[model samples]
Target: MAEWTIGGVLDAIAGVIPDRLMTVCGQRRSTFADTADRSRRLANFLAGRGLGAHRERHTLANWECGQDRVALIMRNDLYPDAVIGCLKARTVPVNVNFHYTPREVNELLEYVKPSAVIYHRSLGAKFADVLPPDALWISVDDGGVLPELPSAVRLADALVEGAVDQRISPSPDDVVMMCTGGTTGRPKGVLWRQCDTYTVSMNGADHAYAAEIAEKVRHAGPPWFAVSPLMHAAGMWTAFAGVLGGQTVVLYDNRETFDPKAVWATVEREKVGLMTMVGDAYAGPLIDELQRNSYDLSSLFAVATGGAATNPRHQQALLEMLPGITLVNGYGSSETGNVGFGRSQRGDTRDTFELRDGALVLAADYSRFLHPGEQEIGWVARAGRIPLGYFDDPDATRSTFPEVDGKRVVISGDRGALAEDGTLRLFGRDSLVVNTGGEKVFVEEVEEVVRAHPGIADALVVGRPSERWGEEVVALIARAEVRAAVTHDVLHTHCAAHLAGFKVPKEFIVVEQVRRLGNGKADYRWAKSAVLREVTPA
Candidate 1:
């Protein structure tokens, strides 16, 4: 396989296939030629503002000082060009979650110390006061009531210049940082070399397979839609895969919030073939929308989910709605890209994912890889084509990316077991594992059972402080129907049928909604806080 940089591969593909449609968002569409030409001009635009890799900087109080960073805080619609332009200019593109509060935005910018920012006009207010005074700002129009940012350059004005390709040569080792927040408090940037990320997560094809993938896209590729926010690693990677394969990429144009009906309408209009979403956060609403109205969904052949766990009930519901459609659950993270894929059948919708090459189960001590049929639950890990480490976080990098048996591997925080059939049974993150009365219970397992209840819309389980037991399992449930219908006794009975007695929720906190992160991940921190504040007796 010939090593390929992100910009190099994109340019090579664009040069060969210039007339192909590259992206579609609402009323706007860009072909490969337009994307290439516009991105090149944008890169030149950024470079003209003195944003490039070679720009030296004074060492900050504690942060590393090198390579100019360009923060991206926009939605999925205009994300590709901003990212591609940054890469073409050899500038690091840092992901900024737009859902973050102003304080978080300020904190993240202080930590990242980016010299430039590309943000949506709708989100300009969030960073107007917090953005670095010297940062070069460019705002993309979102056709909304936008805040005034006097110092920022309008995207249209920037793109008015003549098309000129950036001649900057980017090394395969150029850094592409993905900012992610987990159960841990502060967000950390996971750093990956462009080459490693390309091969690992970006649907990289080797010399032997590149032509085949390109040809397939050229001949029979369907329009691809990433329903997840582009700020998320999975969302960006999924959309980028479309560009790599020379397929038209589609994004939801609605900026206010996720509207399932709007997504369905876009699919019908665009004839989207492949749609990617982040688990039940998206699937649950989509299911409700399907039940409410009839949609012409024959064009959608596959729906792939990742970045969060997809409950079996939702999978079953989707399968019932769209018979003969493929439902795929991609299990991996920013650190370990596309490690495995779980396919759901009509009746079998278990969370058992088939392991991809380089993925394995690690023993409890993290000393050796567990062989197939290992009874003990262990950490899911991936070797080969993994990220270098968390950016500027040596301690975290050392802990997450450890060398075992003379081979470096990424220890994804997920806990699971390896079946005798060589499939992995994921049991949520290790951090969320609960121990009550000396019995260990996986939160995801119990949550899955709770969500299966007909009246329950969504659920999150966390450990609460208890006098009798060290920590008791507590469930925070979202009631979709009558709250009385989803009684504690009823949910307990339902859970008891699928889970062990100890795994059942000892306490239930009913709510109208369950909160999720920008990437559709369960906000464990929020759950824990809510349980302690509301459920715990003073």
Candidate 2:
């Protein structure tokens, strides 16, 4: 493998190919030529705003150097060129979540202390303080309300000037901070180096998935539909892969809400072949949308759902809804690149598992088995692609990323076990254990039963803090609006059909919307907060 940098990859792609389509945003599209040209201009624009010059040369001791960071907060618009600009100007792009409130956004900015922050006007206001007080805040309106940042520069104006290719990388190992929240309370910034995140999107465009895409969009570059958030590697991988692997990227501006009807309609209308999904959220909604109206889906060849533990039932329902489509549970994280994953054949999993060096497994005590060399099952460990551990948090790095048996590995904390056939069978996350009267309740089993309810759109299992029982099992459900079909009594009766007596939630709290962070993950902490706030004692 060659030493890869973001700029290096771009240069290689530019050398091998030109005039290839890179991105498709609604009616607009950017060719490889366009991306390169615009990135250079954006870099120049960024540099002119002192993002490169930085108004000073900081010294480590006596030797002075420029160490500027440029942050980005926007939804998936399929414009890798903007990200590419950070590499050019030796700037690190710290990801800012658009869903974050002003307070949450400021915490990220305080941690990064970026020199310049770039954002699309669509989701940039509350995140204004994510940059340092004295830092430059740049704005780009992709047809939205443009916030007035004091030193703001328009991206369109920069692109109007001629673009020239030039060097713009600090180091291969320099951090490009991308933030994602987890079961933990606050969000942890996953920082990727210029060389760390390999683009597997270009291994060979003749593969089955790529070939299927090529068959649909035979015009120019390989086209991919962006479904996940731009901050997530799930979305970034396809976008970059499409660019390097000869595909055009089509971004679905979902605007933080997953509307299955609109997504399927776009896929059929624009002829999207490859897209990403995150577990049940994508599959279930697609299945739900099917009952509403039938849409043409012959164009879609594959959809990779990841990020969370998916039940076999939800996986089965997805396939039942849309037969003949390739539904794969492709697994990976911010720290791990494309590791070995299994494709569903019979009921979410009937296919045999091939245990590679790094396979995910469920441990005996509801812990993640990361690595097991000799025909053993454990949590999946892909230390090879571990992100620069939770930016600025040494304690977290120690806990999550630890050295076992001499080599450093990332402890995913997901539970799974190994089969004799050398495949990892993931169960659920370690933190998802529900304790009730000293008995441990795994949420995966409970969620499986509760999600089976016909009227339930979504369900989450969380333990409510109890003074008497230690922690009581509670379920927060997002039920479909079917004229009061699912009352607490009805759902409790439904759970009795599948779950053990004690595993059933002690109380049911119904809500119009289920709170979730990006990548279709349930924010259990917030859900618990909401449940605690609303629930009354008997």
Winning model by TM-score: 1
Runs of candidate 1 exceeding 4 Å displacement: 55-65, 161-167, 208-216, 348-350, 432-538
TM-score of 2: 0.70
Residue 280 shift from truth in candidate 1, angstroms: 1.4
The lDDT, on a scale of 0 to 1, for candidate 2 is 0.62
TM-score of each: 0.79, 0.70
Clashes of each: 0, 18
Assess each prediction's global lDDT (C-alpha) against the native. Answer: 0.78, 0.62
Show the colliding residue pairs in model 1: none
The list of candidate 2 runs beyond 4 A from truth reads 48-67, 129-131, 145-147, 160-170, 182-184, 199-222, 346-348, 351-377, 432-538
lDDT score for candidate 1 against the true structure: 0.78
lDDT of 1 by residue, 344-444 (tens): 76766756889887999888898788988889899999988787777677788888888988888899888888988999988766677665533445687
Residue range with the least summed lDDT across 10 consecutive positions in model 1: 56-65
Residue 520 in model 1: lDDT: 100
